[model samples]
Target chain A: MSGAKRGGIEVLSGNDMCVEGALAAGLSFFAGYPITPSSEIAESLSSILPRRGGCFVQMEDEIASLGAAIGASLTGRKSMTATSGPGYSLMQEHIGYAAMAEVPVVIINVMRGGPSTGLPTKAGQADVMQAAWGSHGDYRTAALCPSSVKECFETTVKAFEWAERFRIPVTVLPDEIIAHMRENVDTRCIAEAKPFDRLKPGKPPEEYEPYSYEISKEGAAIADFGRGYRFHVTGLAHDATGFPTNDPEEISRCNWRIIEKVEIARSAFTWTEKFMLEDAEILVFAYGSVARTAKDAVLRLRAAGIRAGLYRPVTIWPFPASEAREVFREARKVLVPELNAGQMAGEIEKYLTRGCDVEKINRLDGEIITPVQIMEAAKALHGRKKAQSSD
Target chain B: MAGRRLSPAIDIEKYLRKRNLPHIWCAGCGNGIVLGALLRAIARSGFRQDDVAMVSGIGCSSRLPGYVDFNTLHTTHGRAIAFATGIKLGRPDMHVIVVSGDGDATAIGGNHFIHACRRNIGITAIIVNNYIYGMTGGQVSPTTPKGSRATTAPFGNAERPFDICLLAAAAGANFAARTTAFHADKLEDLIFKGLGRKGFSVIEAITPCPTCFGRRNQNPTGVDLMNLIREQSCGIEPGGKSEAPAGIRLGVFADRDEKEFTEIYAEMAAGAGR
Candidate 1:
């Protein structure tokens, strides 16, 4: 699909670009069961994949979708699956398996309202925590947030790279708006960006320990079946031998590798966009589609002679606390306008400093936090800061 | 009796992980015999050991993957077939086999099992039906016969058991068969034949759980359980089988030629390229 012709902008929904992004990232296998808003990704890929020599399988359920993806990843192919809230819940079991087995697979969880199937078509950022802690036990993973159609395509490509880089399942969170909203997308840059494929063991079967940590600084090599790597892989905690082990010290050593490898790469994996923070006295923190509205609020406050900036974290998990620390250092107040009730704001509060006052502008009734709402919240904070500084 | 000594012709030691010697199955447990037959089948199937992948869900029988020297995957409860289906589809070159228990394969993983059969994926699913959940201490299972006692069914199992072979046949599998662990030679042959088939194959290998299910009934020892199976079961004629009796059948019931899932998928890929 890549050519040396002229490039132009075209209108495509975020979900449509998600499929395009996956194709561009060298994804050859997609196993997904449909859910609302996110269903278009599967539907589009169903026809697109077969035409491009890739496989698109509609599994019986959500659990099987990720199960198949994890299964496919063992063959050393980049694989992906998509779902919404309830489907994401069912996928948690296999997500844990993918983590424990160190399988590189990408999961696209289109955020929708929920404690349980709360809103099928509406957007919410409630799954941010779920994406981090949804799977059981101790493991470290990366979750990327895409706020627009362009980011959907770009971040998905990056998600595959991150998953392959760390040998962990990476989540790409796009909300209902970004998933369905049609926007101008330029496809030229994607053709040039290279996707990272994890290293495979060059060592012979005799010397290969599949879970051995000494191979690469990023992660260990995963040898494919029939290539004579003939290794044992399981979900239970194991030693470097890739077999189950109950030893406390070896378990810690095994556990720390998955976490340390990802943690070491955090600064490189973390992506945050900052706007107008050079001389700002107030700040608004947001992500996903809500970040777009937060930007509008920032612009409105700036136009009104109020020094306010926006910190939009493109990488949500691995928290981006370091990036936020830079913002908190300058702004006297921080406003977090989330679609959920203070989920991201609660996160920001954890890394938040002593002098900065935090204001939460949350909407939990299956509605987006509008720019007007964020503008009002930022203005109120700006006014308070202006008052304090004048005194 | 089904256990009457039939000399095992193949050398099974080389296929096993010698370091993990002395498996976890109980002394009289039939899992060992079934596992031995599977290893022999793998040895004689003409497929390279590296080209074969054994996927299993959680259970006593599911531990087979840990003992074998191959590309083994130990998955969650009841999802072995699902994961195997993925492995078969992803590579389309490897021979994927699922080794799981009745409770894991037919109960919790029942939906995935039927769908895999329906898709007719090129994977052989070997289901070990021990009539009771052995790992959890004698709980009722999907293949537990009616009126049988279990820890879950103290008085008696009021529910009806599933006929795994028939279910596979109904779900459009190309091959389906049932045999007991005691009939090691026949079961191995059946598995070899199933692996030889192009599409999905389900072999319900009835294994005795004397420590769990056998003592619940009067058959306390593993030998007693095998003797009971020999006396109570009937051999089905080719293409002649019924599920009503809930007894083991000692031969292949259905073997047909059908276009497998991966073959069809490959055809699409080739056509797409053209």
Candidate 2:
């Protein structure tokens, strides 16, 4: 199902750009249930994939959609699914299965206001924690946040690459603003983007072990069922041979490898972008659509000589702990503005060992954070931090 | 399931995984009988040892896939059909078979099962109906006969059980059949037909959970329950269950010649002018 990649400049929304990125990255199969803000990804792919001779299935629900994607990925197809918050909640079980079985899949969650279907048409950055902890177990997750329409396409391609390289589910996190926001994108950049392919077995079937935990050896290769290398795959805690085992040591080894594979590779994918943090006295830690407002607010603060800077995390999970310590060390205060009720600030607070006073600017009324609102919150939080430091 | 011995004439040990021997089934569990029928059917169908991929959901019958020596996949509870759908769609050349139970197929996975049937995908679903949730110690299931006793229904089940064959037939399965553990030979032959079909086929193998279901009801022995199933079930012509007197009719009920989904999908892709 290979076709000449689409390239050159085009005005595309973040959701449409994501589909372009997936197609450019060779996404072979997509199974998703329609949800607001993210529905465009499913709709675009449904028409695009069949034309390219790839598969696109709209399943009965998010759970089955992810289930189908995982099943297809077992056959070595780069499969993906997209959804908003409520659908994202239903996808957690299969996400955990993908992690446990080391099945590579991509899930796009268009952040919306929700504890349960709160706002379908509007945006919310509340699902940052859920992206990391929605599943029920001790497992590390890889997630990329795209603040712009252009980043949406690039990060999606990166999500596919990282998912295959790490053999885990990678999420492309964008909010309703970025998902719906239209902007000019140069697709020529994707031509240079190298989509990392899943590892194939180099040894004979007799010498191969599906979950050997050796990154450089036979363990690196994934075996397809129809291929000569036939092996069993289960979600239960399994040994290197890919069979269920109750032994504590084996369970620990199995669990540790999947975590370590993502953990050690953190520097390769975990990242953040900064604007004017050189001599800043105040820092705004933001992401997703809120980062856009934070950038404008930081620029306005600079005009007034407040020395404010923006620290936007393009990758949310694997929280860039050490980077946060270095970037915000000199700043007097860290202001976290998010659409949710301080979810991102809560995660940032855990790793602020440098003792910088962290303040939160949160909104839960289903409105995207504005630059003026951010400036007001920053000034207020900055005053509180100054008072606390002096006291 | 291994406590009882059958005649030495039938040798199906070659198809079983010797390492997983002394399986986890209780004595006289009818799942063993169903497993035998499946392996014999595979052998008779001439599918190579590596050709078939066995997928299963969670239940007593789901454990059968783990004991067999094929490209087996023990998936999440109630998602076997969904998982198999992907496998078939991913690699249309491979043969995908789903071995799930009545509760797995008709209750939790009912949506996936019917949708797969509706799409006419190339999959053979062998659903073993034990009347109750055998894995969870006799909880009332969607297929649990009304008036039957269960742990969750101590006074007798108040809910009506699903007639799964009719469900599959109505949902547009290319082939649908019903049999019991007593009809082991017939079950094997029926599986052969299901495996030979081009689209979604369902073989609802009605087995007895002697330990939980039979102990609560009148029939306590595995043999007794098998005889009851055989006596109660009536035969009918293929695609003709609607006209038969309705007391759980057996034999093939639907066999249509619709286009398989994956083939149709491939054909559509080929004509897409990419």
Name the 10 consecutive residues with the lowest summed lDDT in model 1 chain A: A1-10
Native A-B contact fraction in model 2: 0.64
The superposed Cα distance between candidate 2 and the true structure at residue B204, in angstroms, equals 0.7
The local distance difference test score of model 2 is: 0.84
- TM-score of each candidate? 0.96, 0.95
Residue A192 displacement in candidate 2 (angstroms): 2.0
Q: For every candidate, give the share of true A-B contacts it also has.
A: 0.78, 0.64
Model 2 Cα displacement at A150 (Å)?
Answer: 1.2
Give the whole-model CA lDDT for all candidates, comma-separated. 0.85, 0.84
What are the clashing pairs of model 2? Answer: B1-B26, B239-B253
Candidate 2 residue-wise lDDT, B129-220, digit = tens: 98988989989999888898999999999998898988999999999999888777788889989999999999988887789899899989
Interface RMS deviation of candidate 2:
1.3
